[model samples]
Target: MNKLTLLLFWLMPICLYCQEDYDFDALLDSTSVLSEQGAYEQCFQILGDLRQYLRENPDKEKLFFLNIHEAYDYTRFGYYSKAECLFKESIQLAKELGDKWNEAYAWYGLGYVTQDKVLSNSSLPPSEEGKRAFFEAIELLKAEGDSAFLVDAYDAQGYAFFLEGKFSEAIEYGEMALELCLKLNDCESEPNILSNLSEYYLAIDDFSTGKKHLQASLKWIKEHPGEIADEIAYNVYRNQADILIHEGKIAEGEQLAMKVLEYAMEHKDPYLLRETNKMLIDYAAARGDYEKAFQLQQTFMSQLDSLHEMQLVLSHDRNQTLLNIGLRDKEYQLLGAKLYSQRVITWSAVGLIVLLLGLLSTVFILNRQSKQFNAKLKKEVERQTKELRISNEALERFAYVASHDLRTPLRNVISFIGLIQRRLKNHNDADLNSFIQYAKDYANHMNRLLNDILDYSKMGERRLVATPTGIDLNQIMEKVFPMVKDDFREKQGILEVGLLPTVYGDETSLIRLFQNLLENAITYNDKETPLVAVQLHSVANGHAVFCVSDNGIGIDHAYHEKVFEMFTRLHNMEQYPGTGLGLAICKRIVNDMGGEIWMDSSEGAGTSVFFTLPLIEVEHEQQSQENGAKAAMAVA
Candidate 1:
């Protein structure tokens, strides 16, 4: 048995332990059901009772995470500092007990309360400290041979990276998390990973990729469709609505958003209700229905104000920042008096007067400055920052458009030159033969450059002439595999094919994504087994995940971000034998097609590149794919 089970066994009476502690188990189940049914206060009461009972004769080490969960309940009710202190105590207890999983959980709990997971906090250094806790958790799980928990740690690290705005590395660790979870058939881990992947894609403006994950999430919902909790389905609709709005289909999006509000009301989940109302404000505004938006915004503000008023009383001691500022001068002067006892009376009177005057002065100055000088300073900074952001966005737009527009004539010039070279290569003259080779070589070189730019442009200027259709993406890979069969044969590398599912996507982009990733795998090998694997499947969100993995001369982590940029290559042209834009084109097309392109590699062990495509799983596409597959099978 693991430590958790053993600890539970020790906690219960022998008779009760043998019978499985049914009351405790029932309490947990009841709490889950109540929370899912949107009875937060009832669930909160149950949790409190359980924690209180457990704490009365607490097994300090075993109860460490119990308190952590107790703190989670507190945080859900807006008691953030109490939650933070409880989590910190749990972390210390977990460390002393050598329980890394609980330690990691504690760090995650604190982070969640801080809005470090939900909001941008550039003021804080990237929370590498939390990452270290997770790393420790993974190492412990690995030692225990618990791959599932190890996967959770990997995900935790990825979340930390995401919080820090390190998208590429975030994907890398996230990919590792998925790899481990997939191996273990860890069904519970799927929705969480898919949610993160959706967030990542949306950040990069890869709408399809984001939709893909949400799509997979729908299937996961289908897996236990009846047992599905209200919150799960509600989140699915809400996230889909958010994506649809971003994709500029606001009417459809608003309908979906309304569904979320309706669900929240039916369940009476104040938290979900608050979130939905907040979302409705944006959705209503987008629909150019300002009246509804304003109303929703007012409701949201009222909710916050009420909560703030309650918190002011229930959470007085929770403001550590305020307390620290209050206590510092008093503590300093007290220490000074203690060190200089001979002058205590003189120092005491002087300190008292100075402290009173200083307090009044600070209060007055702070109130005055905050109202005027601070507002002006804040406005100026915000204006400058807004201007910079606009300038940056304009530059990115110009680059994308210019690259796209230049590709057409450039493609014609290169194609004509190719024809010229083909004609000249047939000449019989000996001196002309040498000349033909030179012309052919230079033409091909120049053609590669223009082709790279054109392909990259095609990716950036993505306007799907046709929407995605479902394909057995793995079968598509089989077709691509044959084209590169000769290269594999020449290199004597082993290719591994994992279970692949049918995916919906633009065939052209899918083909290019596969081709480039596979090419990278094949070309950059030390030629051992030179193993390459083509893995594909459905993920929780409406996405088809595909990966091309290789055991090769892997890339360093620093270059991972650089690798996606156009013409970014670790090896020189002569050494690598091609334009670096191949991977960049792959990255662009994958991103443009509403997907992500990311790499996972160290210096030598292996590299696995993962990308997701929009799944064809909306209302009507299922029938279309089935008919297409049946007809193709008949032809075969």
Candidate 2:
């Protein structure tokens, strides 16, 4: 009986090992199927379960497959960083296991993820790392005689080249992929390769060759309907429409393009909608339907704007997801540390039973480790905070550049509207003229809004570069008065000055600050004879406070704070023709100069704006004068 028991115990582990292996294989297969079917949630659940199982069982081979499957799923979900990390982990495991095939697969996955990462983050330069990874993958796959994956690798390389605008190189690799796919008798990827080839050829203006490839791709899809996705087939058809239009088959192309547009609308695909709308616009222009063309252009621009807004939202979500992932990683690290501590405590308990000295040593080690972990965590938090600040600054710069670029198109639109108005001047159609005038007005308003946005974005950048110097408020007021002198004179406004003092700040910023305040005082006033007063409020703590009070229309207490916000307006543009950015800009300038600004006013009462600026010390002023004199004497 004892001998039988020993034998059964030995057999039991082998049986359990076989059963575990079978279960792992089944889960992996299910995950692959789920991924293929686009059931990513279920796929991820299986992957997560597999990951946990592998963690306990410690199977590197199984872990490698798990990482590969999960990585691809993550890539599909646009989590490029997570995918890249998993691919890298897979590569390490493959290397340890001496599995060249899987290693090449991992490298290919890394390259693919990197390509997407670079595309999504346009600020990043083209990724040579991705290219290098593809090359490594190709070489490895070639050595292993894996033609199936090699085709994908070649296709990816071609796509990368296409993205970089290297058309010829793209064609070269694309042909290689097509040839390999043909030899392998794989019709599955053939249509995709042909479609890509068509695009490549079209890029180089080889219309005839491009059309041939496009036709071939369409034929393949038509013959094997289920092989290609409906979206892909529609895209292929859209490309055909583009070619047809380019070939001057306007009527036929318009018909097909309209169908594709319908499909795009039904699916609500922004990319497809934009492309189809763009093609339709061209079609309208070609047919000499200027009115239709203009309307289509408007639609295109609106769609483009919507797409941009969506992209921004997606970008925000992506950043939030990445932050969450980072936090989760940190949490996992903490959990691991806790687990290690628990193990250490359990060991220490054993040691305590054996020797109290061992337990004491363990306690000391734990204390030191806990301090080190805390210090590391603190450093990490600081680093992340700094990175967040940099990211915010970058976003500000992006906003500035985007708003600036938008002005060019807006200017063009306004110019076109002006041309239209001039051309229609002779027609004298009242309704048409009124519509044109409305368009012109709206365009002008948009222009003003964009200009304000640009100015607002520039404030932070100027603050970073501006050097503070002793500035004479009296001189600043003199310079500012002229810019708004016409308005004051036109309104018969009286500007009173009460002996302004010199303060330390950027001269230009100070000039703008007062100009904005003075302009606001004059513009917002409902009084027939507007009276604006600049007074020295106080001087203390090395800073001087100044006030600009207006005897015009005053703001309500509820809107006192709101008035300082960008784009905030108490009245319509018709009543007050000014961008609401003036006060906001003033606030930013004051804050940048290490001061504060506030308003004291009530509805229908005169308003008072108070602001502060640093005061130049007497010693510094005298020293500056002496230095200036010395320079003048040396120059003479």
Candidate 3:
């Protein structure tokens, strides 16, 4: 009888723990339903309540799940920093508790948030950090023998690969994910995985395979209708339309594309709307409807611009919300301080009248401070709003310029191709050669334009944060001179090099800057013999300034700064045979290196480009000495 009692006692805690877990799981299911219904705030409130209860109860197991859900919720709302912090905390807690399932989920949440951050900030979609996190999650889930979360992990891997443009790997992983979903009997996830696979196949131009996957996804969506069904079906239909359009089923593709647009509008999915508009624009262009195509293009650009503006607004709102929360916390602290002072006054109430006067003064001071804080917050919000508006307007103007400039060359290419095709039927070799040459020239110009544009845009992403490294500008110039040596020899250009100094910067960017300037000097010169000279001099604070001067057909005073604006060409394509992106690229590269670049030129005179760079060795030595002094002071 004693032994039986001992067994029951031992089992009691186990049974209680299981019951607690069950209760938490049920609440989690409710939260999932709310989230799926798009009631994120309500879902968050429920999660908050659960968290409060967990805080009171102090259950490590329950806290793990709560943190994971909260982190994921934050990520969904673009609270990347908060989500990242929570995910890291949850991961540590899960590891301490030996909860492998929650650990995997935490890692997956972190990865998803990182991916979203990359996508928001960059045009490119590839994310190495996200891929690593998802792979780690997959391994953990596999070890746990968890089929449910494993499906998601596999799908995320596939999605990452797709973004990275690894089409074959994406298709393989997508198939693996779909198979797992089917095996797990997760009908809701199965359709989305199939849709993902279809998109992958479409990316690789495998229309038949893409069609097959789309059919499968459509069948599943129809069989198991849910909120996810609508979202995934929208993408599936869009891909199907794309495949149809590629296969010459124009009317059918247009119909499907229109349906996708309608669904996107109903759901208010801006991304999907933009994608559908792009498809419609392509269709119009294909059907030889230039007017319709132009209108659709304008609408597409407007929508894209608006989407960019909306993103800025959302980011600003998030910051504003955080600021308000901080203010509330500060108010709470001030209230606590007031209460403390009042308590002290009450305890020391040798004179009740003095205590009353003290309380009154405290109240007045607190009110004034609160008013001041509120006023400051209002001013900050207004300033940020104005700055955002200015940035958006500038971006819109840039987009217009880019579109107009890029389209002009493409239009020429198309016209030349059409001419070649029509004249090819007449069997005239001479005309064919001329048309083909024109097409080739335009193609080369387009290639140069695209390269320069890519370089300009990638400035923000590349290696721009490292400490300056010492490099000899003379060696850089020598290396660059060879690239334009033929042009110099052909033009009989007299290239003079003064004593160039070693400076600190990205060597590749510096070389490209010199190469472009020299190329421009040679290419733009109409003189029988061109003269180009480069010289350097010492500047303040361990810096060297350099100037590249050329006796080429100089720029007008009015167009001096304009030359640095992208695609601002004064000469026609026939005369220049180049895109007007070189100076702009050079200026951006110079600025990125913590230097300035400007032109000193006038019409009929020579042009001179000047820039500066830091002297790296001297700067590094000075920084070391300063750090040592700081450390010595701290120790003292």
Candidate 4:
């Protein structure tokens, strides 16, 4: 999987919102129906109803399911805080019920939301929380002998990694998710994973594959039109159009976008309508079709007016719900008070009863105080979330600028190098070998720049798949080491491998990851005889830990994290024959695999790098040694 796949998967339909005034089944049916009819007002109205109903009746099994649906609703309406709250609440419920399937679903909900947040901000929030939630859910399912949702857990884990700009890891988990989906013949899951994988391809401008998966999704959606509503179809077409436009199919993309917008207007989906207008304006303007762009803007202004009108309707509906809740509460309180007064007077056993009531009231007041305190905590979380989003946006913009502007020079260098190579062919001097190598180095540098852009651009915009395979890191290294043996020998480096174990992730990404890490160790060495050691050890809960330690110029503590940033090199390119992208790509790969990357060194001592891959990504067939027994019988 790649960035394009991740991006598309980031918008995968890991969501379902419950509907209003209706029963659970009714809400589901109505929401589906309204959406099919393109009646977004009615569709969302049903969602609001379901939200209120679930809030009022948390005891219902339907309400438990509503937890997922409510999150979707809140998210669709741009209430990220509320959406996050709903996911947390549902996860809490799943934890209490010890329900593995639902728990995994909840974790996916978190991943889906986090993925969106990342796209909007240009980076994912810290993923530890998401990974922990997924692993915990996987544990529950495993204990209960329910591996049905194992793929979902892995999928979420992969997504958690992907958001942190871990494309390699994202691909690993995403593949797992895809494999599981295929095994289960889960059409719904298939498209999602495929879409996510497509995002990774897009990240590398592998648009052909991106378009392939997106088209696959569209095809499946058409075949099983019942699975998704018109809203989803609307989104599918709009997204496809964007890709087509970006990939140079301007006319087709424009037609698709316009058609979707037309459909939205037909169905009264004002939000989509508004967004389509903006896209049209930009699309037309970029094509120098100023008249068309101006016309589209005017059309959009009309839609805006329509949207305002629809908003009033929605507001009225919301106010009505609040009024109903208040009225019901007030009525209940009055009736209870009357009953209490009568009981006190009639029973005349009042003194003791009244004393008890007073005690109860006092306790209740304290509880309310605690609830208020909790509310304050929620507010704080919201504030932090907002701040993080703002910071992420800044980072994303900077990354975009850095990628384009930085690549511009590297591209020129590449072009110039080609020119030089062509010119030098006519004059084969004694330094021909060196010149050829220089050209090769320049091409490699350009490739590094492109990879760096993919790394930076990947943060917060891709979905991950986690598919466990029978991987032997030992064997993998055996193969990889031979390829790099000459390099190590040339650098006079003593490379060693520690006890290796099999781990799960995307094969290509992992190979690239290790290859890059090894290259990094060899490329910038202060040691006369550079020493590189690679090891993989099994960790508790089925994780395989990988470490690559090197006897090289140690990095400062302050620059440890910065070193992993794309194009961020402490030393000059002249001093070190590098594009300053190796470490950054390394960090991204580790992160995408649901792992962390950090350094341990004293500026002069060698640097040790360690990363962990959790057991949740493993298949039941080849569980880690310690976890094998636990999974064997359960799988059996």
Q: Best candidate, TM-score-wise?
A: 2
Candidate 4 Cα errors over 4 Å, as ranges: 1-106, 109-174, 195-200, 242-252, 264-320, 323-327, 333-636
> Per-residue alpha-carbon lDDT of model 3 for 233-328, expressed as tens digits?
789889888988888888898898888877765654676887678777876787887667766665665455446546645655655554454344
Model 1 lDDT on a 0 to 1 scale: 0.62
Question: Cα lDDT of all candidates, in order?
Answer: 0.62, 0.77, 0.70, 0.63
Task: Sort by lDDT, best first.
Answer: 2, 3, 4, 1
1-636: candidate 2 lDDT, tens digit per residue: 245334432443343433345456765776666666655544554465456456558989989988888887787666665687798898899999999998998899889888877655545443455568888899999999989889989998898888779999999999999999999985488888888899899878898999999999988988886878877788788889889988888789878988887787665566578768877886688778877787677666655554555665565565565455444444544554566567678778877878899799888899689668757865775676566567657767887998999999989999999999999998867977877886798688879877877887888898889888887666666667668778888887777766666688898788888888988998888898888877778988988888999888898899989889766777877898876778989999899999999999998899999988888743344544444333223222
TM-score (C-alpha) between model 2 and the true structure: 0.60
Tens digits of lDDT, candidate 4, 457-515: 55434423445455656555655665667777787677766555667665656666788
TM-score of 4: 0.38
Cα misplacement distance, residue 606 of candidate 3 (Å): 53
TM-score of each: 0.36, 0.60, 0.48, 0.38
Model 1 TM: 0.36
lDDT of 1 by residue, 561-614 (tens): 888876566986456657677887887677766788787889987888888877
